[model samples]
Target: MHKPNQTKQATARGRGAGYNPDIRFDRVSRASFDDGWDMVEDLPVLRTQVREESAKTIISTNRSPDLSFDQSINPYRGCEHGCIYCFARPSHAFLGLSPGLDFETQLTVKPNAAMLLEKALRNPRYTPKTIAIGTNTDPYQPIEKTREIMREILGVLSDFNHPLAIVTKGTLIGRDIDLLAPMAAKGLLRVGISVTTLDPEVSRKLEPRVPNPAARLRVIRALSDAGIPVRVMISPVIPALTDHEVEAIVAAAKDAGAVAASSILLRLPREVAPLFRDWLATHYPDRAARIMNRVRELHGGKDYDPTFGKRMTGQGVWAELQHQRFKQASARYGLDRRLPPLRTDLFAVPPQAGDQMALF
Candidate 1:
């Protein structure tokens, strides 16, 4: 890991904002200080490393009531889109890594994901259902351009005629228009594009390395123009910071041809809480305390509450006000009225060469 000097730390806003040592491993944490001296400084540049993971199974099943899908596939373990408030950051702790910088700089790629998915679909007991992608991390994150792992997974799904849903903040998904457009036509695919804020500066500091706000809107337009159903996700509606942009984001997505919309209140579960608080202090020091105070109110005077029902959208006045705003905006924009459901009937196991033909 590269260490930033005082000057670099002051100027480098997003790249190393939440860079912290692994608390689980380090007994003592060190901080750097600069003494006025004539010495050359080397600016720190974080490099990404991909460690291939050998996964036996690709499909992950969960019974969480708040979720829309029952199963999902994650092609990668860590995300390059360093969203400070991402709730998925804690997952990196299980791998003995820091949830701060390690969650963004160090990543694991499951190179055999496509093959494993094909094998899972071939199981006789496997049932057809909408398998979600990008639930844990964006499948189309920066490395996807070079790895092309996500593209291969989509190709496998297309071959097996598998129905799947995707939620991503990456613009790279636009590259797969040929695959997504056809699957959407067959009612096998639906996409949710997450737009945090329309403010370019806010997006840059909050979700470092993600596509710009304008670029994300362009993604919505492109996907929709290709005849793929697009849903705009205004997720993790940070109370005081970005809550005001609710209506504006909804209108923009609707104008771009997105048919539906959804949102989630900011969830600061575990390690993400401190990381997000640090981000608030760095970017918006003036309102950091007020923002966190409101967040606590939403989570019942705690940093977070994992209760499923109240998790996505919190409880009480603030939560209700946010929900009502979204409801009114969506209604005014004619979003989320009657979007088509992803079809599971189209799913079928690809026939092997030795497969016997059924007699009619």
Candidate 2:
């Protein structure tokens, strides 16, 4: 249901736009009403959606050494979190949809995720390894509250004693503490909350639907108090944007009981380039050009470069300085340390074919 903006949620253009499958517009705020008197406004445009049922799911596997784990699962395609700079936005283009606003509004849900995962695990040749969740789109992204796909998937992994990791910007993970807390006690689970900025105003503009920074910090404390390991991620350290808050954020998260921390540089890839540029122009018109110029300088004279070796952390004097600052700040707060590893040695095959008890 697309609710027309009342007062708080206005579009960037100060006018409502006609929907075109190919284009997306930045939103703006305005004071009063303007006249179009078109009946089309009353028409319920069935918001576009992407859906999936079941198949031998070929989840993406990558051998990136810098990451935490080798395997992961995505229960949904396209996230609803309207973060303007999300690097995952471009992925929607493969489904013949605009990566702009559609990347958030047009969502694809895999309803059979848990069943498929159980089948995959039951195969005799299947090996048990820690499989991460929320890597691409947040597993606990708003829709999961209703869809229950992530919850179901977690249930299956629990039954099999599989190790798991999750990274999210949402507060919903707190709802599953019953499952997560036990996993942590068994050395089978860990979660990292992404706290982008300390300012609520900055967080509202940057992450849109994501929980506010204070709320996310509360989640960190809640998880820690429950005995579930919590890590804080200061992600996409946009140089002049939120970069200065790194030390402050780490200090706060550490006080809230986060055990370790990590971060990444802003990633602008594929369609995210134009979207991010539009966001910068809308939110920080005065500093937009300067920010892009710095990014280009770091990329060896481009707005962005996709080279593997330096994609996550760009190479240049500026990049080096940012990396050094992060290292220093993390060490200062004692957040550079690592947490206990998730134990994969406890994994086991779940149930027997004739086991009615497996229904539990």
Candidate 3:
């Protein structure tokens, strides 16, 4: 069992987690301290370090009842967006890394994701289903600009006519409109863009590196114009913090041409709990206690509840009210209608370069 240290580091500029928590699986723990001499001001800005990962497989499958799709692909191991409330942060711990600042600064990318995906799809016993992208970490995180791993994966999926659903907060998805638009026409693609808070200040402190609310709205509009079904995600609806913006966010997304809306209540599982608490202490001290209290209330006096059906929605009066608010807002904005599911029947492996021609 590992216990997190209570000491917090000064918030790094343009970064979300203020300090790195002890790796949950490590036998040793470490902490930072100042002795007489002060060098805090001389500390260097945290720079992102990326490593190339040679993945044997690209597609991941899960049997969680809370998820809509079982098959998913995560092109990257860690997200660079640095969203403080991100539920995927804890995944970094499995790599023997902290789920705090390391979750954002240290990233591992799958350069051969497209090749592996193609290989997987070409397997004789494989079955076609909707493969979800960005469910664990944002595939279009900042590094994707140069890595283009997500783009390559998208290209392979399009070539195979594979059905896919993407969830992201990155604005770079707009760059792939050419591929996405054609796939949308074939009922092969849909996207969900998360807009946590409309307030730019809150967004800056909360998400840090993601595009602002307006830019994400524009992404929804652009995708919608391309005939791609867009869903606005009001994810991790923080109780005392961004919860007040639920209706406003839904309305704004609807105006931006989002065909549907969905939300996930804030989750503080594992190492994420302390990191988020530190974030709240640093940014919103006045409301931090109130926010955490509400979160605990929803989770039945705990930081989080991992129960299959209840994890995504939460429980208690506040959770019920939050659900009602989102339900009514979605209904009012005409975002209650669900988008048509991606078609798996269109999936077919295209001929390769040296393949023999088929008989007529």
Candidate 4:
């Protein structure tokens, strides 16, 4: 693990975090101080570093009750979409990296994901269920354009006739409509496009590397037009900032042909809390206090509450109000209908090149 020097605090271009936070598990810590030499201007440009990860297994099963899917596949670790409010940021600390800038700039790719997934699905004892992708990190992030690891994984699932769903903020998913449309026609694929805010300026500052809100809507339209079911996810609705756009976002997604809509309140867990706070201070200092105050109110007067049921949708007056607003907007736009369940009975492992031929 190569640890980068984090002694300087300067805003990196096209990055959300202005500085790296200390890795929580490290015994030793470092801090920045002025040496009276005015060295901040000498810092180098932050570039994304990619590392290949050879994973032993591809499918990860989680027992969290609040989650809709028990199994998920993350094609990559750490995300390039530097959304400061990401809950997945803390996961990077386990890789011996800071959850701040490092979480976005340093990425780990899983090249063997497709191979491992095929092996998992071929097991005789394996039972078919909906396997979700992009639950923790965006599978179709900027790197996916070239890596195409996600495309390979989808290929394996398609060959097996496995049911799968995807949640993403990237427009690259549109490129795979050929693969997705066929699966969707067989009732094996659905997509959730997360749109945090409709405001382009706010979106740029919040999710520095993500596709603009309008572009995301275009992706939803493209996917829907291909006969693929699309769900618009209004995730991490930032209070006092983008929270007011919930109705508008749902309406826009519905107009773009999304069949369903969902929303999650802003979550600031572990290292993400401070990083998001720093972002607020830098970008919207005037309303930073008000925004954080509302977040605390939503989370039982704390930065965050990890309680499963209360985590996704907060537990306060404002949280309830936000939920009500989303429900009303969804109903108004006819985006409240649940997508039909994907077929698990259709799951069948295709014969490999060397497999024994069946004879009657």
Candidate 5:
């Protein structure tokens, strides 16, 4: 039997600027008029909860043809960045948690990630491939400053001369330029910074906790100055919203020292669809329906398309137009360049207790 649906009221402090419900769970929140609604207007502050996750393995392999890399590692399960349109949000439902506020408030960290990575790299049968980081969640999220799990994992990768790529919107990634710069010099690393919109107000409501667009651009410049390759990702381009800023974003990144640029059409999978809809309703009520309507037009009349090829770029007129815009922007801004691929041949396992020394 299905459980009874439960509802909770969202308070100013606990709810994001564009708060919404997680579609996976039966529990939801709504304004109650019985007590004049003011009774629930102000609630206690919501604190973040961090949990320890002892994962059996560190390396995760995926066969998705659309992905650039085959293996990846997520030091944290839930992101505190709190991007309302995060595609990774739906994955939180598998943990029996709400993909709404719970996803941002509750988090899990794998403290042993460095050791596990080292162990995996030591495997005799293991073959080297560029390991992707921050694919599911930002490795440099706020908590990383205290947890330092991402730093530890980077240490392991640096020691093994492992090739890796990172994608993030966190400014904290600058703290690890010491690790990344050297790896990049050896053709073993590349970084992608995701920037959604240039408007700080829009960013505040959309990806509330992430760094502002200007700060993200500074990160690209800093990384590029250190001889590290930077790829500006104008990601999850909302059709009726920030879509107009595509060329401007690419041009800005190019001016900021980004070597290359790319983009992904916004994806609203499963629980994310309703959550995103609610977000649009809260923040852009006037254009909410029109935006989703355009999204459906791109996704074959559905909220999203999970098919590999069409999922990233979508189909039809609008998608083609966006594709053409990106191509033109890249060409116009000289942003159509490729960074050297991360090198895998330099991988070497450090000597263990019983290992014999190599002859000089």
Candidate 6:
């Protein structure tokens, strides 16, 4: 007989912030355990990952007002950092996988990513535009250390003088100091480090495998000191949870050398909603209801509203309050303004080998 869908309503957020992911379906229940998940994984277990490739050399562009860039590239899918509240978790649904463990354990690495990018860049119709990385999945996540896929992509971008932006939570980026520093000198790059909370307990439970808040601040300092523009992203300002640190986090990043700063409210999209709910019920049972209640209030009295204009910043009293706090604190720290724009004028496509027809 086929196994039943045994894990109904997985939770994604308790150990983290609002990005927690858990799987749930029909007629499934979890095993009753006396101790919590923290007790269950005392010893480190080797994580599993799946690698794959796509046929395309390049991905097309779509317009989104919230995001700055039109085109993007992801060398890997499914981050291994295992942050429970990762919004990218639901992307696993496309492959008929659960957003819980499947998202962290089953990953895809594209070995030919740099080759394909170079090919696309050399295309006649290709125009140099800022290609966003680390938008969907972190390029510098744990697996990067071994795979080095992101490093290869950066090499290609540097060769062609392409403008790029990265958002990350790992310290692995420090390894790319050589590439990023020169790009920064040319005003061709920017980096954003997401700092969710200052409290260690909160950081451990929420982001689990990612770097600590202090470590992330060091990233800001290191990147900024190297001349790269650093933005402190106080992301997903979790109400009744992480919202308290909005000002303090900003203050810390500014003092550390960050030249700019921004914040985004928590977003619970599709499979993410149920997973986050399950996490709340499992971990913070007492405040679960209140947290969801506040999320709805910020999201216009609903779990989530997909309205394009309202998605990034949400709405209502709580959202407005979070925005106000960020605005005031950022202004005070001289981080209210946007960083200088990157230069795309340096981009150039080199000729392929034996294209003697051009010389003739």
Q: Total clashing residue pairs per candidate?
A: 0, 4, 0, 0, 0, 17
Best by lDDT: 4
lDDT of 5 by residue, 1-360 (tens): 111121243442434423434445546534323444445344555668999998999999999999988999999988888888899988887887777777888899999999899999999999999999999999999999999999999999999999999999999999999999999999999999999999999998888789889999999999999998899999999999999999999989988899899989988888778778877877899999999999998999999999989998899999999999999999898888776677989998878788888899
What would the per-residue lDDT of candidate 6 be over residues 1-360, giving only the tens digit for each residue?
A: 211222222242222323323344423333433344455333333346676866475554759787788998888878777666677877876665667666776788888898999988988898888988988888898889988989999998988899999999989999998998998888789998989999887777667778899999998899888888899998878878899898899999998999889999888887677767766775678898999998998788887887888987988877887889899999999999877678889998765677755543
lDDT of 2 by residue, 44-78 (tens): 33343556646467355768866768888988888
lDDT of 4: 0.92
> Model-by-model lDDT, in order?
0.86, 0.78, 0.90, 0.92, 0.86, 0.79
For each candidate, give its TM-score against the true structure. Answer: 0.92, 0.86, 0.96, 0.97, 0.92, 0.87
Clash pairs of candidate 2? Answer: 11-27, 11-28, 12-27, 12-28
lDDT of 6: 0.79
Off by over 4 Å in 6: 1-46, 351-360
TM-score, model 4 to reference:
0.97
State the lDDT of candidate 1 residue by residue for 77-170, as single tens digits. Answer: 9898988888888888788777778888789999999999888888899898888999999999999999999999999999878888999999
Q: By how many angstroms RMSD does model 5 differ from the true structure? A: 3.1
What are the per-model C-alpha RMSD values against the true structure? 3.0, 6.1, 2.1, 2.4, 3.1, 4.9
lDDT of 3 at 19: 81
True-structure Cα RMSD, model 1: 3.0
Which segments of model 3 are wrong by more than 4 Å? Answer: 1-11, 38-41
lDDT of 2: 0.78
Query: Model 3: what TM-score?
Result: 0.96
Tell me the spans in candidate 5 whose CA falls farther than 4 Å from its real position. 1-42, 352-360
- The TM-score, computed over Cα atoms with residue i paired to residue i, of candidate 2 is 0.86
